[model samples]
Target: MQKLIFSFLMALASLSAPLQASEPASTHANITQEVNDWLNTSLSNSPGAFSFELRPIVSRLKLDGCTQREISLPQGNRLVGNTMLRVKCIEGANWMFNLPVKISIQVQYAVAARPLAANQEISTGDIAMQQGDLATLPGSVILDPATAIGRALNSPVAAGQTLRQEQLRTAMAISQNQKVKIIFRQDGIEISNEGIAMNAAAEGQPVRVRLDKGKTITGTAQLGGIVDVGP
Candidate 1:
């Protein structure tokens, strides 16, 4: 009878040991989920639509039950592109770990709607909008159709080619030898004169103008063939 009692007690202890070991595993899963939730909430306000990829923690950690977790980014780190996040347990266990993250955003940019020849003036019908992963495209991609419209292309672009700011030039807003109104404003006083543009220039760009009596002056080109001269 004594031997049977001892055997029964040993079996009970062995069965209960596994149950105690399972608690840490469950806590670790909860910790991982907490970290994930924190990251999603933190980046909810980022520009454009984004998706996140989190690296799994392979090493086993013996951490106590954490009452609070603090998530932070490294100094000078942006939420875009590939970055790292620091997860620290502010309450209970005093431990920290780094998580590798890859952030991808969907971006809409302008592209050539059809094959365009060199020196061709770009119009509203010449461009189209395209959506793609920003990380995979060039850094100089043009995001707005308005920016590309009315610009002259410097090189031939294939159909569906992404438009870049460097690939286009501003269309001439003022033509050479055109009659223009030259205005000068200083100390709340306004002066106006008639002048002929000496060179073609884009809007908001500098243009040389020939005023009456063969006087020449440089001024900024404005809309409606107007030039602004500083006193």
Candidate 2:
């Protein structure tokens, strides 16, 4: 009778031991799910439509049951491309971890169809739409061919090179040493004078012009080579 009772007690203890161990596993699974859900939500609402690849956490961290978990991007870090994100458990233990994430967005942007020379005006034929991952590209890429066409290149670009906004500018509406009408308005009075453009400029940009009296003045360039100067 005594031996049977001891055997029964041992079996009950063994069963309870496994049940107790499973608790930590369940908590770990819940933490992973929470982190994944946060990542999916953040990536889905990013600037462009992107596909994301998340690296698996190397080691399983057995944290306490968390009542609250917060995920945030690192300072100055855009939620795009390869970046690190910080996840913190605000409740239970208040622990944090950094997660590695990769984001890729398929984009159609303008590229140079041919080798373009510096100061060359971009024509319709010079720009072509190319499909690529925007996250992997550099600088502010030009998305539309219409925006690139009719603009002058600031520097020469090789064929197949991606077009960037900083690389192009509006074609000069006013040229250097050209005649321009400088208009000024003050106190309801309008004045106009003829000046020579000392520097070339695009429409709506500032230009330096030499007045008829040989004095240099800076004014805003307008259409038809007109410069507006303010008193």
The most accurate candidate by TM-score is: 2
Worst 10 residues of 2 by lDDT: 22-31
Query: Model 2: residues >4 Å from true position, as ranges?
Result: 1-26, 45-48, 144-150, 184-193, 211-218
Residue 20's lDDT in candidate 1: 68
For 1-231, candidate 2 gives per-residue lDDT tens digits of 999999999999999998666534226456567767877787675445678787766565656545677878989776678988787878645577887888788778888999999999999999888888878887498876888878899999999999999999899989999999999989999999998999999999999999766789999999798998888
| Model 2, backbone clash pairs (residues 3+ apart or across chains), number | 0
By summed lDDT, the worst window of 10 consecutive residues in model 1 runs over 20-29
Candidate 1 regions with alpha-carbon error over 4 angstroms: 1-27, 46-49, 62-67, 75-82, 90-94, 116-121, 150-156, 165-172, 175-179, 183-194, 198-201
**lDDT score of residue 15 within candidate 1:** 100
**Candidate 1 global lDDT:** 0.84
The 0-to-1 C-alpha lDDT of every candidate, in the order given, reads: 0.84, 0.83
TM-scores for the candidates: 0.64, 0.73
